[model samples]
Target: MKLKLAAAMLAASLPLASMAFAQGTAPADLAMIDACLKTAEKTGGFGGACVGLVADPCIKAAKGANDDVAKWKACAARELAIWTQKTSEALKKVQAGGFTDVIQAVNDSQKTFAASRDRFCAVFDKIEPGMYPGDASYCRLRETANHSLSLIKLGAAVNEH
Candidate 1:
């Protein structure tokens, strides 16, 4: 029957759909990484080099570092430091403005954003208990970088108004 054939096709496609979702970084993030890599390759600047190197450990870990807990811990610590510094500087800049309602909103939103970042990273912990710290560190790094960029754009817009 037509109905039975349609149901079977949908069932067969479910795994493929899941596989696609599970593979690779999101498109925007991939673009950002590619940009960073290109800059590092071209200029050899510290910022670009740092961002470019963040994934090296992960790639190594994928090959075998998963078996070496120490390496993961080190990578996680390094990433957390980068995330903390970037987020702190971004928040400070956004908060340094005049005591207006917009500034207050930005401050409140930052507190909320920090909480959200923790919760979002916690999902990685939930998925792989053993790799939690490393996984969460990478998540935090990506989220913080994105947040910093957003705050920078917001600050520019506020200044423009």
Candidate 2:
């Protein structure tokens, strides 16, 4: 009985122990975005700068802009949905895995959210206020990207749990 109680105590403490291992990626991610925005401004153009931000992993830290913007949005949305779903899975995993339970799920969700934000930021910056070419498409992409950012923020919040 004592042994069993000891084991249960150890199990209960695992999540809190692992939570200590979670590090903040916010500063680095924001720095990358800032750098990308700077590069975009320096490039002296809207489209190229935006695309550059999307492509540079160091800056965007996520890659998925290769496909058409519409397809990309669909993919990102799906990816985020999976991350959100996995949060519960993470909790369950933590309950069972002892320590590694929620780690993967939280990390996966964070990565997806970051990627979504980067994709959206890239596309959002491209839509100049007065640009004539593909104005409607630009608007749509911007909306999609904004939605992705929202998901990313939500994921980030969930990670705190």
Number of the top TM-score candidate: 1
lDDT of each: 0.50, 0.35
TM-score of each: 0.53, 0.24
Model 2 — TM-score against the truth?
A: 0.24
Q: Which ten residues in a row have the lowest lDDT in candidate 2?
A: 16-25
Predicted structure 1: clash tally: 0
- In lDDT terms, how accurate is model 1? 0.50
Best by lDDT: 1
Off by over 4 Å in 2: 1-130
Could you give candidate 1's per-residue lDDT for residues 77-133 as a string of tens digits?
444444344444445555555447766676566546655776777687556636554
Candidate 1: minimum summed lDDT over ten consecutive residues — where? 9-18
